[model samples]
Target: MNREPNAQLIAVMDEAQVSNKGLAKRLRDAAEQRGMNLGTSHVGVQRWRDGAGIKPETAALMAEVLSTKLNRRITPSDLGFFSQLTPATPPAPPSVGYPSTVSDALSALNGLAEEPPKGPDAGRLIVPDAELSSAVLSWMISRPDGVQADQPASQRVGMRDVHAIRAAAETFMQLDFKFGGGHGHKALRYYFRYEVLPLLNATFSEQVGTALFGAASEISQLLAWSAYDSGNHRLAHQYLTSTLRLSQVTDDRMFGARILSNLSHQANYLGNHAQAINLARAAIEGAKGKATPRAMSMYSAMEARALSNIGDHKGAGRAMNEAERYFERAESSSDPEWLSYFDSAELMGEFCHCFRDLKQRRESVQYAQRAVDDTDPRYVRTLGFCRMVLAQSQLLNGEVEAAVATAGLAVEGGESLQSSRFQRYVTDFQAEVSAYASNPAAAAFNEQVRDALARLDDE
Candidate 1:
């Protein structure tokens, strides 16, 4: 069969200044790096360029190589591998109408329950900055209304049901903090789909309805966080949006602000620095009077993170100062039960992140030390993340030995946790430490990380 020449592949290969021979070599090298042995040559590259069909797995591997070389995400479709792209771009999520009212919010949540899983393999579905901004604006301008049973279903719900949900949500949150989001993720989803969704439709008084919605919102927000941690961005977005709608119905402005803060954190993680900044600011603005100082401090710290990410040193400094001031004013007694986790240790971790991004290695290391030292041992994921930050800071400070030691601890701490985000941190540190692999200690650490990651992949 005659095939069309792969102009797109040829163009990108040229842009990367890679000859067919070079690409073939790099492909083999990349596969070797992944512990896979794939044979390839200039002949294979020529065939691909001539539009001969490529295996989807090989195309995905090629996309990964190009993405790493270009320092940006390059899907297989971008390289004219349309067959490989099919799995990445799934069908659109089910629509349940716009979330303008409490009923509408419930509809959205129900639709989300039926939506197909966009697991790790599916490419991210990014919300544009304009759309994100518009959502924030809508949430800000919207006023909460009293909730009541519009049309009750067979099941009866009350304060007991709400309490049960809150209890279950706390358990899942604890599991998430310790074992990472993938742990208990399926149980949480099952609970939401089977147990939680029915309560939303059950008969309840106005007061019970209000509290029930609040519980629903909390669980949905937790779902969003779990999805984000698992690298399922599309599902996370849906759960977050639905949470915001439910929060509106529950009249919990502060809770809504926290959801926005979650969005900021996700945006920053995805490299949408500008949008992250905007989302953080919106959280601060939207919860002005309702938010406790602890909550405000967390929001401001998120802003600082985004600012530092965008290289706005002065802006980040100001935001950091604001965050510190808010923390100083924060009293645990006055804060909500949910915001309890944003303690001093977490705050220090935030500072560590911002300072690291700003290249303030000394400050970053100091804050990271405090964060790691003060964090509870049970919060394994937090420890893993903070240790990675400390490792990066130490490496930048020219303390190669110390950096290697710290990164080794991070890898060990991450062993029990099943978070892809945490793995990415380890992966990044591996890349950074590769420069020092000539050092005996750094070489050992590199091998350790490689083994750990390989084990993860096998499981």
Candidate 2:
């Protein structure tokens, strides 16, 4: 029972006069446009044309390439990659458009909330890597959405609704820090769908409307962060990008810079250091003297991370020194509440990470231990993550026994959390311990982690 050839895809490719290699190149370019780096060679393209299934992320991009060529949307199903997997959520309407207008941005986000949740529950990283070159340029050039003095009433929006939105954002931030993003992401979706969506339609004075947008943007950023923690990178990117746009709409320079910083951080994690550096720099530029020093410091620290990874130690050092200087002059009370988490403990973690990348084990351990000691239990996922860095620093310093204990503490603290970042910490710790597998203590730690990871995977 041989299946039919991919005549649809082949015919489209023929009409577009696109070779396998050309399509692969276009897909990679599309990914880069969204600050992502995907590897799909011509060989993979040939396989796709031979009727082999492609990764869903790649499939979406391939469709985009064809869509651009043919001036028509082409979905994966049309290309013959359809599977029996249950639909996650109905796709947003095509007319929703980019995050250009307040109406466009809100409609897009609300539509996402309306989509049904997916099964196997593993979230996809962000997608539809549409060209944001325009988005970035506009952030630098356009006036922020000016004050709206009034809107027609679905219901008179009140101070109470604004308060509720702020409170929910704060609560969700706490939950994500303590329990990881996956802990209560559903609450976010529910809050957006049931609570915030209605308010967007509610009547409000200009001041109240501004406040509502600010509060809702905060919640949206939290949703983005949680989605990233849950290993749904694409969703995280989409949410973060839109939140950044929302920040612009609200004219909150500090918040928009912070959102860009998060996007920069994600790019670094995904091994796209060049893109990370570009995003961090863009944040600083977009802030245009409006960013608080603390916000500047956070963005600079992110740049330092990317610069160091890109083999620019001198540049990394200069940027890091700039961060420390700015942070010292920071008036925390004057800062937005969103920057609260970027305190001393978080800075120390960044310092430790910098030295670790440079292979300065002793210096790294000193700062890493400080981060672990300073980490509050309320920041459960961060505490677990810092412990892993300390453990690795100890391992690199030839303190194998202590490393095991530190790594064990991290495993205990983060085992139940669904954070890709914390999971990476565990993974890196195991790789270090593998060298000492012949040692009994190391073997025990490995077994402990094995069981913990099993539970995580099962979840």
> Which structure among the candidates has the greatest lDDT?
1
* Superposition error at 455 for model 2 (Å): 4.4
Give all candidates' CA lDDT scores.
Answer: 0.80, 0.75
Write down the RMSD of all candidates, one decimal each: 6.8, 11.0
| Candidate 1: pairs in clash | none
Q: Distance from true position, residue 435, model 1, in Å? A: 1.6
* Candidate 1 residue lDDT tens string, 100-192: 777777677677676736456233345666667667888888777667675657878879888999999999999999988888777887888
Q: List model 2 lDDT by residue over 116-216, tens digit each.
A: 33532232222223454555666667678864656666588877889988888888899899889888888798888788867877878878888888888
| TM-score of model 1 vs. true structure | 0.79
Candidate 2: where are CA atoms >4 Å away? 1-98, 116-130, 455-459
**Per-candidate TM-score against the hidden true structure:** 0.79, 0.76
